[model samples]
Structure formats: C-alpha cells, structure tokens
Target: MTADLQLWPIGNCQVSALLNAAGSIVWSCVPRVDGDPAFCALLDTAEDGNPPRGIWSAELVDQVEVRSRYLRNTPVLSTVLTDARGGSVEMLSFCPRFERSGRMYRPVAYGRIIRPLAGSPRLRMRLAPTKNWGDPDVARTNGTNHARYLCDAHTLRLSTDAPVGHILEERAFRVERAHHFFLGPDEPFVGNIGREVSRMCDLTIDYWRYWVRSLATPFEWQDAVIRAAITLKLCQHEETGAIVAALTTSIPEAPHSERNWDYRYCWIRDAYYTVQALNRLGALDVLEKYLSYLRNIVDEMQEGAIQPLFAVSGESELPEAEAEKLPGYRGMGPVRIGNAAALQTQHDVYGQIILPTIQSFCDQRLFRMSERADFERLESVGELAWKMHDQPDAGLWEFRTRSAVHTYSAVMSWAACDRLAKAAAMVGLADRAKFWSDRAEKVRETIEAEAWHAESGRFGASFGRDDVDASLLQLVDMRFLSPDDPRFIATFEAIEERLRRGEHMLRYDSEDDFGLPETAFNICTFWLIEALFLVGRKEEARTLFEQMLARRTESGLLSEDMDFETGELWGNFPQTYSLVGIINCAGLLSVPWSQMR
Candidate 1:
C-alpha cells in the first residue's frame, strides 16, 4: 500500500474503502464505517521477509504502467495496467447500490470486473483479510467457485467467474476475456455470476448519473463541486442517516505529531456543515436524512446537553482506545480507534441541531414538514442552548485540556434562539416567536460586550482574550454580523494578519493540547478565501482559490490539513469538512449562470 493520501474512495453509503494509486484495496471496514477493519493494510507493516497482509490487489505480470480514473458521475473506478510486452487489462471496481424490490438495495459487498484491453495480459489476484484490527488472517473455507471468509462479526463470501484455483494460490493466469468477482455476505449465488454482476454494474452507473443530473451545480468548477458532493454523500451511513468526518483515522495532522483521532463517527458540527454545503447545491436528500438523525438525537436528549459526536448507529458513548497490532500511517505509532471528545462539553452542538431543523419547518418541497409537536420538541433543545450560551467547554477545535467561554459557542447559542424565532414565525406562533427573539437579543448583547477586543481591534477567539482563530472568520456566514460591518472588517483584518502563512492559513497561531501545529488547516484556508471576497479583495481571493484547487489530489478531493511550505496533504483522507469548503467557495466565487449565458 502507498504511504500518502493519494487515494480514491468508493462506497455504497453502507461501507467505504480507500484504493491506492496501483488499485490495491488498502483501507476498509467491514459491515459499517466504525466496524472492525477487514482490509487494514493501509496501516499495516510487513514483518521481516514477509509480504504485507490485509490487502486485495490484482497485479499484472511484469507491469510497466498504470492509469486510473472514475467513471463519469459515479464512484465506479476504471483502472488499466499495461505490461512490458504491450499487454494490458482493465479493472472496474464498485459496490452495488440501486433500487431493488421497491426499496434501496445496498449490501456489504465489493465488486470487480477484469477484462482484456489489448494483448493477452497475465494477472495475479490476492485477497487477504484480517480480524481483530490486523491480528491474523481470517479463517476460510473454499467452494468450487467461491471462498467463505469467517470473520469475528460476520462471514464474508467471495464468488467469482475466474479460476478459483488460480485465485486461491495467487498464481498468474492469462486474461483472454472478461472475469467477475463479488465479495459479500455469505449466501448462495442465485444465478450466473458474470451476468448478474454486469447487470448490477449497469444499474449502479445509471443510479449515480441520475443523482448527479439533479444537482444544481455552479457554472464554474462544476466537476470539482460534483466530485466533492459525491464524496460527502459517500461519507454518510444511510442506515442511520449519520455522516462521518472522514473515511480513515489516525493519519496524523503532522508527521509524528500524534494529533490523530478517529473520524469515522458522526460529529454534529461536521454534519451541519456538510448539509449546509449540499443544501446550497439543492441536494435535499442528504439534508432530509440528516434531519431525521437530528430529530432522533433531540428526542433522546430532551433538554440534556448533547455530545459533540456519536456513532453511525447513534451510540452516544465512544470511549477512546488504541489498536496495538497495526503500526500507524507511515509508521507514526499509537493508532487510535475511538474518540474521547464525546465526553467533553461542547455547547455549540445545541445550535447546530437547531440551524438545520429550522429548514424543515420553512421548506415547502420536503415530503414531511415540521408540525406543532416537532416545534415543541425543538423548544427543549433551544432552552438548553439558552442555559449554556455563556458556559465553559471545549470550543470547535476540541481542545484537550482547556475550557473557556468560547465566543463561537455563544454566537451559535444565539443562532439557536434566533432561528427558532424565525421558525416560530413561519409556523404562525407569534408569542413563541417573541419569546425566542427576546432571548436571542440578550445573548447577542452579551457577546458584543465581551468578545470584542479593543486593544487588538478585533473579536477574540473566546471572551476576555486577545487570541483570534479561523472560526472567527465565520461571523458573516453565521449571520451574526454583516460582511461590511466595521467590527467584522476589523476582526477579519486581524485574523488575516495573524493566521495567513503565505497563501495558506492556520487555524490559530498559539499552541494548545498539541505543541504548535505544523500544517495549515484546509477548511481554515477556505474560510479565509471567503472572507477575502467579502471584503472586496476579489482578485486576491480568486488567486488563492486557484492555488487550493491545484492542491487537491488527482481524485479532485482534499484532506483535513496541508503543509503550507511544501504543499503536501496531511491528516485524514477525504475529509467532509474540507469537501464542504470546496462546495461553499465554488458557489460564492463561480460566475453566475445569467452572466455566463
């Protein structure tokens, strides 16, 4: 497996896996996003004189060159490998997802189709899976045309049209025609494997293209926005309607800096941003599903403070732990599995829930609209926001050992009250609207009095502090302040002076739980670009945006962090927050359709 973020993601909204440049399956979890990894070779280290385990690769004998790309508008990948003798083979990889039997049929399966492209090409297929987070190869039983891998949680069966003996022995064989492989839940293959997989592939392609055609894309960067949108959609667990932060965990923020944490679970803050960006593109399916998830969380909390995150299954308790067997990405040890942030107090989440729920009450296109009972349930959440608006907790950065009355949290709390009033007005509850508006005004007055730092001529990161962060750049987007407000202009200038490193931007200048951040946070840089455009620096904003677009991997996606000096990507792969940035900036900066016409 390769040791970088130059990877492509393919999923069916149920499970996801990362493929290296050579088309090897390096990182994937079985069953679900947070389940035990069946292909953990991305973080695996080979023993002395031993080949790497936990990988699935189809290698061409005497391979000379390889080219890979995604099928237009779909997650299906097409990879071609050429051998020294001018022989070539193409492989199509995907997970089946389409409507079947009047419902969506997305199983825990991986499909591959290999066909000869030119001359006779020899191929070797190796499929090795591990259990207990890279401990040992799973036990298996073989059939005439398939193999059953017995995992701890479930049994995975692989049925194929290729020679079973050649696959089991990992021996090279000639590819004269097409071959098919389907690895999924242990069950009988009902029909001809070749014909069935081909049909699934065609239907899957149609499904993705239909979805893409429905997106309201910006005139410029339409391809970038679509890929980012697809990537974000793949990050969600459709069963629970919970969207994850990224596909992989423990890919450190900086080399050996130990800033890695598990991101497979759903964070309230991250999901909010994902929906907001997709909503701009008029992708309401994602927003509708996420709203369902928020309602479940609100029903359970019933006025209690919500955690920053939860599992895809909506499991609230995620105690942090480490996997001892696997070494880390590029051998940066201490690979963690769960996140401890769930136990911390993050009052900002109360507002995140309210922000999205308000849409259902106002939108006319949804199948299910918010009703009086829904409004009552939301009131409990708003009451909690009012109570915790000025309380101390970890801020959006999720600082480990620090607690402060963060200005961002307070502003979000105000948003909770502010949006609730608007929703109440829409639902024809004048008394309730006035009640929430009064609370919002009180919270706003307090934030303005305390968060503004006259000495620095800007709003501080937290109340009564001189420090500023990239999140402060969100005042305009959050509707807390107008873009041209004098106070906001002063704060933007201060942040630009403190955080901008060349064309990139850091989250902050000061040290926190980790010593000093060695890489620029990708979303922070995008936030800076938006702020620049708002302040009438249009040309400068466009230039910096072009620089960021150039930095994305060949897959048209970005990670969580970037090295400002070397321009290398660090942190987790296919970060949803970073993808949200791409969509948000493209919408703001792209030429209007009216002008283009």
Candidate 2:
C-alpha cells in the first residue's frame, strides 16, 4: 500500500480533509453542528459508505514534494508543493475574520493558489464540492475567474482574485508565472488581488502573535506552552466563546470499529480546565465571552436538565446520524455525528461549570454586571447540585455501558456548591449564599463518609465500583483535600502504582467501559503534576513535568491519549482540554500560589 497522508478538515462550517496531491475527505452536516456527517469517508472504507464525492479526488501526476505549516500563530494554513518540472505552487486556507450577530450561521472556506517566483507551475488540480455528504447533483455556475457550486442550503463559490486561465468542464488547471488563484463563496474578483492576499496573510499572522503574547507565565517550556495555548484557542468558537473538544469528528477509537464519535461540541468538564488556562494566561476576553455563552444556554438546556455537551450555537437537539458515502480514515467504520452522551446525566457538569467561572472571576477580577447575572445562574446550578447530590449518573467518562455514582463527579459537585457559596457571598446574595454554604458542607461531609475507601486509602472511581480513577487527582487541584493529607498522598501513590503508564497517567482501570485500547490520559497526567506540587513533591513534580513536556509532538501539540505500550499519540489531535491541562500544570509547578495574583 502507498504511504497515504489524510488531512481531514472539520470545523464549525466545514468537514473535510485534504490528502497530499488530490485525494481528500470531506464531511458536513446540514443546518447545525450536531447533525450527522454528510461526508464521512474518514470513518468507513466501503465504496458505498462514502459520501459527497469529488470533494476529494485523486489524479495521476508526476512526482511532487509538499511542505505545510500554519502562518505563525494564526489559523491560516499554508501548503507549498513542487513538481518534477521545477514549478512550485502555494496553497493557503483560512476563514474570513469578522464579528457576527443574529441567529444564522455563515461559514465560508477561503483557499488561494499562487505560482512560484521563478515560473508558473504546470499543475493539474481537481475541484469536487459534495452536497449532503457526497449526495450528487451539485449545481455549478461559471464565472470570469472562478466557479460556484451550490447544493441544498450550502453554497461553495470558487473565484480567483487574480487573472488566470480557466479550463471549464475539467477541474484541472494550469497557471502562468506570478499569477494567483483565489476561491471561496461570495469573493469578489474585480478588486486588487495581489494587495488583498498580502493584507490577509499579514493580518492573520498579527492576530495570532498578539493573542499569544498575552501569556504571563515564563515557564521553562515556554515554546511548548505557547503553542499548546494557540491550539486551544483555535478550538474556541470565537463567535460564542464555546470551546470544542476537538476539531474533527468520527475518527474511530479503533480501526473499523463502531466506536467513532462526534467531538465538535463544547464539553462542560473540558471547558472548566480550558477557561482556567485562558484565565491564567490573562486571556479573559475570550474566557468571559465563553462564560456569557454558557450563561445564555444554561436555561435553554431542557432534556437532561443540563447536558454534558452542546452545539457551538447552544442547540440542545443533537441527533446522531451516519454518512455512508465517505470511506473512514485508515478504514475506521461508521463515521458518526451528534454525540449521544449529551443526554446522559453527568452530575459533575454543574460543579465543572461553576467552579471554573468563579475561579475566572476571582483571578481576572472580571466581575461585571453581566458576570453577576452569571453568578445568579450559578445559584440555580447550585440548586441542581444539591438535588442530584445523592443520585447516580454516567460519571465523567460518559461510559456507554452503565451509570454509576462517580466519586469525582460528586467531588466536583461539592466544589460547585462551595464556589457558588463563595460567589454568592461576594456578590451580596447573602440569603442564597447561606443556603449554598450549608448544602456545600453537607455534601462535603457526605463525600468523605461514602466516597472514600479505608482499606484502599484512595477515592474510588465511583461509590459502587472500588476502582480508582485518574479524575481523583482533581482532589488536589480543586483543593478538596489538603495537599499534605496522608490520604491524598496515599491516593497519589496508589494511582502511580496502578494507573501510571511510564510517566503519564490513565483515566481508570476499567478496559471494557471506554471501548478503546487502554491508554494514558494526557489531561490526567497533567493533573497529577499539580497533585505532586500541592503535596510538597516539588522536585518530583518538576521532574515529572519535564518528562510530560517530552511527550508533546515535535510541533508542540498534545493529543487526547497516548498509547501506554508504544508511547504514540492516539485519539484526537490538538485536544484543547489536554493543552489547558499542560498550561495549568506548568503554572502551578513554576509559580507559587501567593505570587499568582
């Protein structure tokens, strides 16, 4: 088999991946983020299973060399290819930067091709825009410099800002020296093409650099930290402040397996650490935007009271569907959309959302009137926490097999109640403050009595299951246990003995529950770093932190999981929550608590 590289492009509006040369994979759901993938070649291998054909196609061509990179801190991606004829082509991808309002969603993909300085590259390029995940009959309109493809409610217009030759009917094209080709929906070709390209590139670079400069920590691994921060920010939905779990969907946990899932929604547990990282870096503008987005959606969540995840636009209805038109990545099966976990009762969400919001307010001093409304909402969340304190649910992992009374969820629930009490008192909601405080104490007492295992000397994964969970590391980060407490230290040691995979940590011991080959959880390992520091194991924490830094990819990116045996990255790439964990762990390890403010 040929060594094929697949680049799946998935974002708020686009679901596609470009392979080297012409082969590509694209998936899109109609109307909303949670809709099923229409182009799911990244999930299934059978020809009949693929959709939105021609969006990704391959043609015979001479030898070509390619190199790609993001333009310094910006989401703008640039790829350069050189053919055997000594001609070179540069491809650029970016979404337009603009402020949005109202309810409708407008997402456009902008791509431009440029010839090299020496001469025009004799190149054969094919364009296939799919509709309904490879469903046919895409209407095409020819223009002076570009072609427009429209299907259903989606419109993809390919226009060049520069003058170039066009060979209609055939998607292949050849360009002259010093010429540029621009393609996107609603792009004007009459304007100054050269100037527009230069300006967009410069603006995108400047935006990323400015945002990255906001970091306050000068840790030893500064480069890694900043890159991770940039990746996390890219996962953020700038319009609504919601941070997605990952950019891609339906990348199966195991090849040809039915475990593929959609991860493009905002997860409350993930967002808690995400906001904390941003807050620590002094990037509260985006953090506050996300908090407001959450505030807007909290009341709108109806089915399960409060879902674990939601669409970036705050839609609660995320129905699962399959895109049978596109072959899966590496032959994984059943590319899916709309996570069913949304309906699962994850009690930790209440605490996960509130404690982080409270921490952000305290750290950044962003207690504006709008934030006060968010605090009021926190009181209601506290009410939910009190009501569900004794109830059993699907726990933090969102296990598909069964529901259990997870101790970590209970711990966070108690923390939420505690943070709400603090926020209520601070904001002059005294009556409500007392109510939360009383409930918080009661819940804390309950957890200490029921959640702890005396013989094991560690918190269990759940009250029913005596297995230890990596999430219990939160006991230190949440300050639920005194760092020096013998029990916390014992728990840490127990986790190290049982769950540690070399230097990293696993989420738990249960193999059948998560439905994938067991691996070290990147976020949990980072949490362990904080646990070590809190327990006065500073040298040990620093050593472990350094080892964790070594785990990052050459580009300084971290994935969701790492193979315990081979130490290779598995699961989603550029996971926002994992990077947030790295940033937070680095901060706690390097800076003293008293000096943080």
Candidate 3:
C-alpha cells in the first residue's frame, strides 16, 4: 500500500516530515517548508514501492501488520511492523528540537532509532535521499559509519550505526543490535553516535513535554487541543515569525478538482487565525515572531499595501508554477508550487494585518507594549480600510476568475476601524478615537445597507449578489453582529440552508474554476459549529463539533478539506485552519475550569 496521510509530523520548526501508515517517510521538504521536497514520493506514484530514489523506510520483509502512534503527549513517532512469522521491527522517528548552550538546536534534519521488537525481524534500510523532486539520485560515498550524498551545491550526510554494506546494497539482514541514524547537513557527529542520539532524543522529549505543559488549554478535549496546538506550532517559521497555511504544496482539494494550490506560504488571513488560536493557548512566541514579519511588511508598504500571502521569509512575489515531475495526490495532475494569489488584491488582509497589531497595543501583559508610533502606523492601515472597504477585490475565497465587493472583506474593514477606535481611546486620544469611530460607524452603515439582501431577509456574500457564504459564519466570531441580533439569525439560517451538507460545510456550493466544490472546507465547518453555539443550539453545536473531531486522522490531525459524503480528509497535511478550529471549538465548548473543580 502507498503512503496515506495518517501521518506523524516531527520538526524543529525549520524542517518537517509526514510519515505514513506503511512505516515509510513520505512527504518532507528541505531547508524550509517552502523549499523543494527532498522526499516527494507522496505525490510521485511512479516510485511508490521503488525506493531507489526518494524515501526513508525501514522495511520489514513479509510484513503483515503495522501500527503507529506518537510517543505520549509528544511529537516523536513510533511505528511497529510485524512479519508473517510474528517477527517485528519498531521504528522511532523525531527531529530533535531542544535547547542547547542557550540556543534552540532545531536543525534542518531528522533522526531515527530502529531495533528488533520480536523474533529477530529482518530489515532492509531504503534511505534513498533524492533531489529535484525525486527526479535525480544524489551521488553517495560511504565511510566507516557515515555516507555523504552530493547533490549540486548541497551535500547531505547520513550517519548510522548499522552495517554500511547492507544499507548501500539494499540487502535484508536479521537484527542483531539496535541502530541509530541521523540524516542532516554535512556536519561532523559530535562524540559517540549512539549516545549522542539517545541524549538528543531525551532532550527533545523533555522539551516538547515542557512546551505542552505551558499551554493554557481547556479542561476537555485535552488530547485534541494539545495535538492541534503542537501542529500549529510546527507550522510557525520561528526565525522570521511567519506561520504557514500548511506544510504541503498540491494536495488537491477534491478528486480531479484541479483546485490544488500551494499552501506552504504565509497567508495573511490564515496566519491571523493561526496566531489568534495560538494566542488563546498563551502561545505568544508565535504571535511575537509573526508581529516581526508584519512590522517588516508595514515598513515595506508605508502606504498600506498588503498581499494575500507571502513566502515565510517575507518575499512578496510567489509566482505560481507546476512541477511536472511529480504527480499530484492520487494521480491528480498539475502539481503546483508557488501561489499567484500573492499578486491578487485580497483586501481582507488590511484588517487581518491590523487585528494582531491591535493586541500589542491593548495587552498590558506583553513585555513590549505598543507605543504611539505603533498606533500612528496602524492609523495608516485603517485609512486604507476606510478608503477600500467597498471596493471590488478578490474575496476571501480567492476566486481566480472573478472579483467582487465581498461582505466579509467589508466587515473585516469595519472591525479594523472599530478596534482601532478602542485602541485610540485606551491611549487617551479621544479625538483620534472619534475619528476612527466615525469611520467605523460609516463602514457599518455601508455594510448594513449594501450587504443585506432585504427581499431574502439575509446578508449576501457580496454587495450585489443574493448568495449565502459560509464566511458569513465568521460575522458572529468577529462580533459584527451579536447572536441575539435578528439579522444574524436570519443570515445564519440562510447559510444553513445553502452551505450545510449533512454534517459538513462547504465554503460555497457554487461552481468555481473546477466546478462545484466536492468537499467541505474544514475551517468553515468549525465556524458553523461556533454559529450554532452562539444561536443557542448549544447541544447541536457540541454534537457537530464532536462529529468534526471524529474526522481527524489517527494522529489527531486534519487536512484542509473533508469529503462531505465519505468524510475522508483531503488537501494539505497539518492545515493551520483546521487546527485553529480544534482550539477555538474546544475553548468555546469546554466547561469552565472554575465550575470543573
């Protein structure tokens, strides 16, 4: 069987991998998440079982049974494969993420520990580290305990404790001893290989445990909350403070949908929700890093221009291109790399950029509170919001073929002005507060008048259209309308009738670039859950929330989309949007800690 995304993620925030159920390392990128996939077999069906080119698998010959799980509240993964004769081999995989000498020692690397579990299991180590999206094999030369693979200007070294001849020849051998392997940059191994890896493993485990301990998660759904939080943390590029939408490139949204897009970049809307979710868990590290990225963008766009997405390094131009070498997930072709949406004017970003900055102004708990300069800079963004609140742009759904004056975009604009008004008041600038407040109220008036489809008694998706969008569910979350408000209920009912598909929620059922959506947008489903809760359908909300949780992978993770009919996961792995849903719903549904005691 090929690799399924019932996978585990191990990373130090610099690099990550998705190990599938077959005990094979499937999808992993190098240098950074947006960089080339060194092991790209997750999408290359031509090399499914041919491990001569891209994979790292410890195959157990005559294998009949296999099982995998994370090592107890940690990101470290352990998998066991048993052969027909009850012989078994266990593999433990993790990328060491720990503090060393007053610095985080998270490298662009991975480490694995393999040993016999029962009956002297036979093993064939297929550590084929390829390059050019699995199209070329790197030239390798072995030493006594290490092998260096040279690919262009890059050199990767794999240090192992197993027999070098067995690894190079792809020969199976009966396990006589435990082995350790570390595949990383061309660097010398410090001290004994086995002892060093063991220590690193211990330190990594402790580090993750401590990080998990620090989370201010809700009382219930603790496992789900922790896993989601950790996954979101992995999505963060700590060096530049950019949070990616997902770790993968072109996993199609639906079968043959041709809607596949690269999601590894930092989207303003996606990042905002990610930081907001992490912020709720007291993960300010991600927020603080992302704020740095935002500050740079703000300086670059002194006139308040912003893109929908950017490279994690804050590069603005992410031109979309297809990789013909790799087949898409399940042979869905047109495997894409960069995203063109970076150039499209996604106006909702103006507010998303400001929303997090507003936190720095209001939160007294932060060590570095916002100064007058910060608020003044934010005012420029609010001015842009005021000017462009009703302008036509690529809406949040990012329709490639069309642009419109999206209601969600306008409401987000109103939110920016509304929040800035309060920030101004907090700083005792009554005049500025009134200025922003007036702008906010005017924006609100425009939304109420234009976005409302009066004959239908509902809020429409765009100014002139009578469509109900699932994004409307976010109106309550954004506090644009209170649950007690009649307009919200009517609009929500309209969405329920139009977008809800049994237990799933589609972003919209309308035909787009690839016809009608064949799956539910996972985050939108969570929004529906929140809307249900706010509308006093608390029981129904909890039921739906549980149903959504049931769809998560064996690793307690989710992809970007889910099949409405079969409930199968689709799109990219470890989606920040879906992870945010888990955190938001858990926080909303969990019984109060005060009452729990």
Candidate 4:
C-alpha cells in the first residue's frame, strides 16, 4: 500500500513512529525527532528495480482484511490481520513509557507483542530498516535471540523471542503462541523478554489512563478532546521540552504541489498554541516543561530577533536540504530534510514566548512559579517586540519572497507587552507593570492606525493593504479587540467572505510563493470556528466544527491541510497545530460542565 495521511503514530515523547494500515512501521526518526529516518519507507519510491525497503511489516500470509485502533486513552496501537482462511493475528505496538525509579522512564524504543487470535495464523516478518535518508539498507548482524542493524552513528538492536532465521530470511512461520519484540538501543536482554514486554505494556497503559483522568474535559466531545490531547503530548520531545509541528515531514499540502517541507522541529508560534490548548484542559505539565524550552531560547537570544523555528535541542541554526535518495511521498520526489524557515524573521515569536510564560507567573498550581528574575529576562523579549511591532518582517505565515508589516505580528507583539504588564502585577511589581502597560498601549495604537482599513470597514492582513486573510480572525482571540467590537465583527465578516471555501477556510485568497493555496489550512479553519462561535453564530460554528471532526483520519487525528473539494487530508501527519484546533474548538463549543448535571 502507498503511504498516506491515514497513518497511526506511537511514541514515548523521545522518538516516534508512524504505522500504516497493514501495521508496518513505515516512518520513524531514531535518536530524536530531528534525527535521520531509520524506517523511511513512507517516502521511499525506488525506480532502480528494487522493491521499496526501510519498512518493518509482519505479513499475514494471504491476508484478506485489516483493522486498527488505539487502546482507549493511550498511544498504544492494536491491529488485527485476518487471513483468507479465517485465521487472524493481533499485533500490539507501543513505546515503553511509565514511572520507573521515581521518575519518568520514556525509552527511545518500540515494543511489539503479537498473538494468535483465531486459527493457526502464519506470519512473515519483514524487518528492513534504512539509514541516511533511505539511501541504503542497514548492515545486519545476528546473535542468538537478537539481531542488530547498524544505523549510521548508532546500532538498533531487536531482541525478539521468534526464531532469528525466519526474521533474517523473511520466511513464513506459524503463530501458535504469543511473541514479543523490543527494538531499541543496542543492548543484551537483561531479563525474560516475554515478561518484561508484557509488564511495560501494562504500565504504559496505566500511565496514559492516569494522565487522561486528570484532564478537565468539556462536557461534550470528551473522547475527541482526549485523543487530540494525547496526540499533542506525543509530539513533544520531553527531554528538551520542545513540541514538533508533526511526526512526518515532506507530505505535500497538495499532490505533487512541491509544498512539502520538513515539520519535525518546533515552531515557536505552533508550540505556544499547543501549550495554550493543553493548558486550557488543565494539562499544566506540558506548559511547565515547555516553559523551560522558552527560557533557554530567551537566554540564548540575549539580544536579537528570534527566528520563526528552531531545533528541538534549542540550536538556532537549521539549514534546509533535500534527501535525493528517498523519493517523496507517493513518488512526488524532492523529500526535504531540515527546515529553511529557521532563517526567516517572524516577529510574532516574542509574543508566543511571553504568552505561555505569563501563565507561569499567574497560575499558582505550578510547582515552579515565575519569579522576578524570570520577569527581568522576559523584559528583554518585550523590548524587542516593542522595537519591531510595526516593522516589516515575514509575518506569521512566513512569506518567502515578500515581507510586510503583518497585522498578526503587530497584535502578537502588542500581546507580549500586554501580558507582561499583567504578569508584573501578579508578581507585585508596580513600576514594571506600568512600564509594560505603556509599551502595550503604544503598540496597540500603532495597530489600530495602520492595520484598520477604513474603506472596507475591517482590518486587513497587513498594514495599508486590502487583503483579508484568515489570520485577521485572531484579533478577538488575542484580546486586541473584544468580540463585540465593531471592528473585530467586521473583520470576521470580511474574512469569512474571502477565505471561506465551502466548509473549509483558506489561509488567504491571494497567490503565495507557490501560487494561490489550493487546500484549506486546518488551523485557520479552526480559528474560523472559534471566531464563528465567539461572534454568536453558534449553529453555523457547530456545523462547521463537526465537518472538520468528520474529516479526521480513522485514528481521530488531523493533518496540516485538506483539500476542500475532495475532502482529502494533506500535508504533515498528526499536525500539532491542527490537533490544537480540535482541543480549542471542542472546549469552546461543548456544553458547559456545570450544566451537565
């Protein structure tokens, strides 16, 4: 089967893998999210008479049907393969993660347990992993009860109870009993593999369940909210507290559109929204961890414009390049690696940084509250926001060849100063509170004077322009203008008229670097839903939100973009920005918890 957006993701925060319908680990990055793809068959399109390599599959002999789903409230995936003769096998896949030694034990490993469900099912295991962006298959070495594959700088060892010859030679074997496989760092088995894998599965399930139970879900759509929340958490690299935009990269926004770009690293703007959505559900753990990432970025930037994106490790330099070896998704070609967006100047990041950090000072529930020292460091970011709130830069959309004084960047800059004022008051600093408040007022005045389009009686996307993009809908959400304000109301109406295409919302109507966008951006559509509900268009908002929910993959997750006409989801898989929209809209549109009684 060809690679598609309908893939399942299983991860333990450190590393993740995307599995296809046949329960094959088709795409995964070892070491870290930004590392090389160890199993990159998702982008493999060999034309050299070679069958596609870099996939791990347990081929059920004469398989006739397949079905898969996530274990409730957990990231563990279970797939059942039914053969033509009515025999079936259940494959359970997950990454080992739980509380161990009084701390979190999230390993960079994958665990699979297979058992016969019906008659004696025969299985042929295909465990081929590639290295250096699908350029060549990894050299393998085998020992008793284990096989090791050399993955460039590191070795990936698979410790399994199945016969080594069957796996090495791709021979069919009978599944008379249960089998366990642990693929992780090169290491010898320390304990009984069967007992350990089983224990890890139970512990992992318990960990996810207990985590979900702590969430304060809305009265409706609890299941969808839980799933989106879990997927968002999966996108985070907990070790560094950076949340990636998506799991897979180079999945085109539209077929053969060359819109594909690597999304494995963190975009400051995207991470802010991720933490904000999770924070609304009272999942402060993510916010707390992410605050550390922001703190490091703030410190490192002592004085400079913060880039739009960064490596999860907090390294600033991310040079873009393409992996010519692996053909693109569906053989589109030109699969990209590192993102070039890191080189762009996106002034809105200052607000994104302070937006989440302000919560640290205000929310007393957090274990580590922001102190005066933290506020002092944040003032540096605020100073930059104040300095460049109205300057021309690559707006939040990250326009490639053009730069404009985007309304969104100005409003976010205003928000940075505005929130700092509130945080100062929370920390009992009167002088600094007044200082930030004055700066915020100045930035607000600038936006009102420049972004407001008097002729159209609505705010435009950028200063002194007639374009109305979906981002203008965020004015109310950012609190730059009240929902009842006539300007915000007019802006929302104008944006809907221009960007709304059927049930989907385009980021903009005008042509971009790749010409006019053909598919609707998922996050922008969610923004519209929120705007619709906020403007008292309750029924219409609910209907549109339902349409988006229906478009989700069978796993109840969304990608970055979707074709409005075909309803085909495109772009990166399990996009955090898209998932954040799910959680935010569900929280807004659901019935109040107080009325549930």
lDDT of each: 0.91, 0.65, 0.87, 0.91
Error in Å for residue 578 of model 2: 2.0
RMSD of each: 1.2, 4.4, 1.7, 1.3
Instruction: Write the residue-wise lDDT of candidate 1 on 364-413 in tens digits.
Output: 89988898889988999899899999889899999999999999999999
State each candidate's clash count.
0, 25, 1, 0
TM-score of 3: 0.97
Could you give candidate 3's per-residue lDDT for residues 448-561 as a string of tens digits?
Answer: 999999999889999978987899888888889998899999999989998999999999978886788899999999999999998899999999999999888888999999
* Per-residue lDDT of candidate 2, residues 485-562 (tens digit): 887888888887888777778887766564544667788888878887887888988898887777665445666776
Off by over 4 Å in 2: 1-61, 98-107, 117-120, 161-182, 186-190, 301-304, 359-367, 370-374, 513-516, 536-555, 590-597
lDDT of 3: 0.87
Between candidates 1 and 2, which one is better according to TM-score?
A: 1
Task: Give per-model TM-scores.
Answer: 0.99, 0.86, 0.97, 0.98
Candidate 1 residues lying further than 4 Å off, grouped into runs, are 1-3, 47-49
Order of candidates by lDDT, top first? 1, 4, 3, 2
- Candidate structures ordered by TM-score, highest first: 1, 4, 3, 2
Candidate 4 — which pairs collide?
none
Q: List the residue pairs that clash in candidate 3.
A: 241-289
